[model samples]
Target chain A: MKTNNGSSRAYSITSILILIILAILFLFPLYWILTGALKTPAAINSAVPQWWPQEFTLRNFEVLFSKRSAPLFEIGSLTGPIIPGAIRWLINTVFMAVLAMLLTCITASLAGYALAKKRFAGRVILFSLIVAAMALPKQVILIPLIKEMSALGLYDNLWAVILPTVGWPFGVFLMKQFAESIPGEMLEAARIDGAGELRTFITVVYPMIKPGVGALAIFTFISSWNDYFLQLIMLTSSSNLTISLGIATMQAENSTDYGLIMAGAALAAVPIIIVFLIFQKYFTKGITMGAVKG
Target chain B: MDKTLSPKLRRQENISGYLFLLPSLVFFLAFVVYPMVMCIWTSFTDANMNSNTADHFIFLDNYIELWKDPVFLKALVNTLIIVFVSVPIVCIFSLWVASVIHKMKEGPLSFFRIVFYLPVVTGSVAVTVVWKWMYNNYYGIFNYVLKSTGVIDKNINWLGDSKFALWCIIIILLTTSVGQPIVLYVSALSNVDHSLVEASQVDGATNTQVFWRICWPQIMPTTLYILVITTINSFQCFALIQLLTSGGPNYATETVMYYIYYTAFKLYRFGYGNAMGVILAIFIAILSAVQFRLAKEK
Candidate 1:
């Protein structure tokens, strides 16, 4: 019994050490960004890489809010002239992300319900297509997608950015998985009691799958919020740029302002972190839902 | 309920399902499936951006030319390197962390799981910015740690050097950003038949033996899922690279996605870009098909 206790104690100690290391590894980046955001530009770029800032100032934030500075980065093509407005870009990003999330959730829920509950022709083909689409690297369609966008006169527009991503296969797939678990007996009863399919979806199915929708909302929000390339390509005008584009522009305009750049990055990250915290349970449930269903 | 007795009404109820799916189907066909088909067709044509002349079809010309394009070849090499280096490392590290969480009894272990998963929430832009700072040569935290620990005498240029930049980025890739794998592994572990474990223990099998022999086989499907997703993700990787390096130091870090973006947008070579895009689609399709086949076979 004593030997067994000793073995367990050893195991516990090893586990603790591993946990601490992983924690530090995970937390260090956020801590660095927070600290870097707070530091003066000079302090940030200094040779020693100080653990603590010598002087803390909100200068970076002030600069971001200030109108005196020139545009952060050139609009398009490396050789393009600098366009001085960054505020519009940030606003556009916010609008695009929110809109995309709203659209993705509604469509995914509707389609997912159809796929899960109702038997229809080509259902297997549609489901398989969605699964395949989920696995597809976005790079595969980017070039032609761009051309098509241009032809449709939606190129360099926020709609272009939002439209392509709204039909996400993963979202549909997640909703289907969640919807599948909703007991068919309840739906049948709803039908028997005079609830139409859409009405049943709104009242019964939607509430039952709120957890799944919440998870999908968070996922779509994060993906759209973090998206860089599509926005970079589609939003050719600086005034229409997203946060990612704005940050990229900072590199070109003044790569030397490490503090300023880090500040922008922190700002970009705030919404995602907030959403994740609020939906943490949903997020975890979503993963398990996806894994098992797949 | 008797209202549904009519044949027309029955047809309408069935049609509602299709109606509900209409929006997604339209978008999918327009944005996904159509572009996919067009990409293949465009690859064979001498397609250029903003041209008045119709596309001149030159069968297999683009592919033949692409085979010789040093940049495409280099991009392919860089992408493969990221995949081969990052996937196994992330998998092993994630499994180790998951196993650790599995061993712990709820309190600290749950917190550890959250910590490991924190990166998944922070978004790629934040991750990229933080890593860029860490990878900075002279004053970066990474260099400072290495130098202070006496592991190296001087700072090693991480993102600056062509050879080290890709590898440096790979380390960041391997960090296993969210608690995704851990949760999956936990579920998989739970689903394992406890009797099998008990029998092994009764047979005097070591903990490691029980894990390898019983747990591993049970979770093989999850492992394959992770493998496929990670592989596809590695290929799709661009935001972080674009943010940190911008495919800089002479296109050293350019992946196919970045290449396609630049080719189409920056250079305005839309047709050529489409051609490259088709190549990518085929590559991913084949790879994913192979993955599904392998998983099924097992």
Candidate 2:
């Protein structure tokens, strides 16, 4: 028994040590991006790689910002002041993520509440359809979606990306899981007291599922921000590009400009990384909950 | 629960339910359902960028041609290789990581989870571009590190070479893929009935025996879920191939999903792209179904 305990203890210690080493290796890419962005051009292209920047400069960012320019804000003829195109891309990305999140939460919570609490005709069929749709690859529909967007005069619009993301069924499915935890009797009480459906949802259902909404909100935001393929296909104009798309186009144009590309990469990655770190608890919950019940 | 509802109450329930679902239903129908139906329908016609008037019915010509097309077949094979190689590696790696971390202190556990997940949250474009620089033959850290470590005597054109390009792409795919499974597995592992494990341990069962006989069966669903999701993700790998190789070094890294995009946007073969999309969907469905069946038997 003593030998067994000792051997197992040694085993765990070795495994944990190995995992820590692996973790550092996993983190190296992000580290390289952050440091590489700040390195001098000569330092960046050096044959002998600098583990850390010998000389840090913001010149890469300066070059990135000056490479292209777009208006700060535009609404029809009322254009706002001009800004660096990178900044414009960042703003566009944040707007797209936020809008997608709000729309997803509002629509999903309402539908999920109904699916969980209300006994509707076609409920099973609708739920099954959602599950099936969720199973299929989302990219398969993009070909027709492109045509549909053009037909609706929304081609090359951020709304094209946001709308499809909102339409995904995962949020509704997650909200339904959260809603199932609400007591049926409480809903019954609300109905008996003459509370209308919307009121009950707003007053009772919304509060109960707030955590789920929070999870879904962050999930959708990060996903929308990083959905490069959709953004790549949907938005063509430089001014309309999201950060990921903008960075990609930049990389393509200046393939060997490692410092410039890394700067753009940092611009694309850092804000989303900050968001993930801040709400990581909820983000983790969202992922596990989606899978566990799914 | 529904047996006690009066007809009038049931009717009211239906109305209220539909009203609540109406908002989400509209978006889902318009964006998801409509596009999906159109994709299938367009696959049967010779649609193109200029087919704004009307696409003529071509029936199974697209699929028939796809079968004959060498590039599509190569892409199909590469996609399958990616899926087969990555899924098992992801599943096993995540399972091991989850098991290790699930027993750790709260701070350390979360740290490991976030570390694994960072690559995923770092938008694929950023990840792919950085990797592109790292694989550069002239000035990449990989070559430097490998040389210093005496692992290789010379530089490798990692992305530009046909032999290594697909594997390099797969490695990145694995990093992004493992994060979700780790989260799922950690939760699933923690949720395994500890009392059962304790009981088995007290019965003089070996640790490996207890894990296989007890925990493995219990977490089979999570494994199955991970399998299906990883398979789908691997099959749909697009952004990496697009930004990295553009399916080159002689189409070594071409995937079905990337080929679909190339055909539709670059080649103007909308019908051909849709046909490939249909086949990819069918492959995913069949794989998912098989996983479900296997899990049930176990």
Give Cα-based local distance difference scores for all models. Answer: 0.77, 0.94
Which candidate has the highest lDDT of all? 2
lDDT of 1 by residue, B122-206 (tens): 6676778778878888668888888888998988888989878887777776664436777777667778889999998889776
Model 1 pairs in collision: A71-A84, B117-B179
Worst 10 residues of 2 chain A by lDDT: A285-294
Model 2: per-residue Cα lDDT over B158-205, one tens digit each: 999999999999999998999999999999999999999999899988
Q: Per-residue lDDT tens digits of candidate 1, residues A106-154? A: 9988998989877666778889988877767775776777778888999
iRMSD, all candidates: 2.5, 0.7
Segments of candidate 1 deviating more than 4 angstroms = A1-9, A67-88, B1-10, B103-110, B176-179, B293-298
TM-score of 2: 0.99
TM-scores of all predicted structures: 0.91, 0.99
Which parts of model 2 have CA positions greater than 4 angstroms off? none
